[model samples]
Target chain A: MLEVRGIQTFYGNIQALKSVSLSIREGEIVTLIGANGAGKSTTLMSICGVTPPRHGEILFRGQPIHRLGAEKIVTLGICQVPEGRHIFPQMSVLENLEMGAYLRQDKAAIKADVDEVFERFPILGKRRQQAGGTLSGGEQQMLAISRALLARPTLLLLDEPSLGLAPLIIKQIFEIIRKINAESNTTVFLVEQNANQALKIAHRGYVMENGAITLEDRADNLLSNEEVKKAYLGI
Target chain B: MDSEYFFELLCGGLVKGSIYALIALGYTMVYGIIQLINFAHGEIYMIGAFVAFIVSGVLTLTGYGGPTVLLLAAVIAIIYAAAYGYTLEKIAYRPLRAAPRLSPLISAIGASIFLTNYVQLAQTPDFLPFPELITDFDFMEPFSRYVSSVDLVILVVTTLTMIALTVLIKYTRVGKAMRATQQDAVMARLVGINVDRVISATFIIGSALAAIAGVLIASRTGQINSAIGFMAGIKAFTAAVLGGIGNIPGAVLGGLVLGIAETLGAGYISSAYEDVFAFGLLVLILVLRPAGLLGKAVKQKV
Candidate 1:
């Protein structure tokens, strides 16, 4: 479980996140949905220690992780697939996946994980030797997810997985996310601008406005909530 | 135009190119990772030559002369240069990681100046004659007219070093981590890579290469001074820019091209314009292709 309490994050003098708070329980898919620049990605970034919150604390399984660096946070089994996918453009798909398992030293297990990832995403396997930049948007997204999955993270942070992808590929990606959570019992904190799809798969959902969380409820409730429907869902 | 004279000049150019390539690598690799020019890198090379000079001199005076002393001197110089490089980064550039780009570049220049003056104060500012470490080989007697044993050794050593570097970058774990870090620092962190360590490793490796070049060049030229790194650093930086600042192969090509052009120009045209040829080519490259030979113009994502 991850707990974020009244965290304020900033870029220079401008506050990007203002006393925002959220929590996710273990083995559940919790999503934070908002429009562009509503501080959704900032929340994940704060948790990941890329841009540590200037105020408040973040606890992972009761351990304070707010002061830790991004590398330390990853070593503690929290891995992030950041917004824009941040795949190493010149590295091959397989190399990107290898980087995902960078911290793991058990060569056999790492190889097994790589093989399993390839089996799950055959397209990635087919294009394993191709540079990550050469992959299409959907394939790159899959490769990004596969890369993060190779980390064998207990807590996976996904930011806008469906961004710039086709509707069919988006559905496939959502299915993969659901399956991953169910099978591995991995806790997921997904940040998405696609509120409808995010709410459909999430166990609980939080609606964010500006730099703070505005509403939190069961996925179905948030899905049908009048304000959520009007503002995020566009129903 | 005599063909024998042309061959001799070509061999001489290659020898110079090998040294430039070795030094240029440090510039390119460091730039690839941090986008800093690392002006102090030349100081590491100069320190390498100084260490080799002192070690070899002491060893010969202490009644231990010949190939083993030469080998020991090179090894010591490499180790010392690597240590200096590691310390230099920790002191100069690492503290300014979060600062503006210009900050670290300025720090690099400051470090370069500091090291140069430190060497001058520690040793002599004047050029000291370096002993001939690489002796002539009996087998090389036949081809000595075209290529001396020293030139052959330089070429062979440079070739081997380059091959080893290529292997390290292509297949090794740390090398992969370096490439990953170079491409995306944030993502490299997310994947549990300690990017600071990668940067230090880069500095160490680059410094090692420069040290090799330093020792070889000192032995070949028969002299070294505290200010030697200033000119060599500029030449290597020019080579790096010529090859495309961040590309490894580009640096090698740039060094060779610059060396050959400078040598050919000096041999054929007036020798006074040796540097003019180097800078002229650079200006031409900048005017025609601002990205350098192998550099791609990076498109900024808005």
Candidate 2:
């Protein structure tokens, strides 16, 4: 489980996240839904130590990880697939995947995981030799997820995986997220603006406004709430 | 314009270009990873030559002359240069990683000035004689008319180093991490690459290449001074810019072209105007293509 307690994050003088807190238990798919620039990505970034919160603490499995470096956080079994599918543009798809397993020493297991990733996403296997920048948007998103998965992370933090993808591809991606949670029992902390699709897959959800968490409830309950329906779901 | 004379001049140009390429790679690779010009890179080369000079002096005094002393001196110079490079980054640029872009650039210039003065005060400011580490080879007798054993050695050593570097950047784990960091530093951290260590490795590798160039040039030219790195560094930096600062192959091509152009201009035109040709070509390249010969014109995201 991960616990974020009263964290404030900033960029220079401007505060991006203020007094924000959230929690996720193991093996659960939790989505944070908000409109644009509501500090959803900042929450994940703070958790990953990319931009450590200026105040407050983050505990992962009862260990204080808020002060750790970004790579240290990853070494502790947390991997992030950042927004916009930031794959290495010049590297081949295979090379990108190799980078995902950069810290693991278990070569045999890494290779097995790679094979499994390829088997699950055959299109990626077909385009293994192609440059990552040349891949279509959906394929790049898949590569980004596959790259993070190669880390064999216990906690997978996904930020806007459905952004800029076709509706059909988005459906496939959501299905994959659900299947990953079911099969591997991996804890997923998903941040997205697509509240409808995200809540549909999430077991629980939090609604964020500005830089604070406004509401938290079971996914179905939040989906049916009047304010959540009008503001995020556009019902 | 006799063919023999042309060939001799061409050989000389290649010898000079190989040295430039070795040093230029340092500039290009460092720039590729972090967008700093690393103004103090030349000082690392100077430090390398000085270390070799001191080590070879002590070795010669102890009656350890010839290739063994040469090899020992070169190896120590390389190791010392790498250490200096690592320390320099830790002190000069690492702390300013999040500072304004101009802060690191200014810090690099400051480090350069400080190192240059430190060397001048520690060692004599005058030129010192460097030993002829590379002796004459009997196999080169047939071609000695156009190139000496030293020139051939420089060419061969530089070629081998280039091949090794190419392999390091292409297939090695550290190289892949370096490439990943270069593309996306934040994502690289997400995948568990210690980015600070990667930057340190870049400095180490780049400094090693510069040290190689320093020792070879000191041996060939027969003399070195505290200020040798200044001109060589400028020329190599120019070469990097010419090829495209962040492009690997561009650095090699740029160094060779700059070396050949300068040499030919000196040979054909007035020897006093050698630099005019070099800077002239740079200005021409800048006017025609500001992004450089091999550099793409994409807008860099802040």
Per-residue lDDT value at A128 in model 2: 90
Q: State the TM-score of candidate 1 restricted to chain B.
A: 0.97
lDDT string for model 2 (B51-74, tens) is: 999999999999889889888999
Across A1-235, the per-residue lDDT of candidate 1 in tens digits comes to 8989999999988999998888899899999999999999889989999899999999999999999989899988899998888888888888999999999889899899999989999998998898888788888888899899889999999999999989999999999999999999999889998999999999999988889989999999998899999998888
Off by over 4 Å in 1: B297-302
Model 2 whole-model lDDT (C-alpha atoms): 0.92
Candidate 1: residue pairs that collide: none
When just chain B is superposed on the true chain B, each candidate scores a TM-score of 0.97, 0.97
* Candidate 1 structure quality by residue, lDDT tens digits, B212-279: 99999998899999999998999999999998998999999999999998998999997999999999
Off by over 4 Å in 2: B297-302
Indicate the residue-level lDDT of B270 in model 1: 77
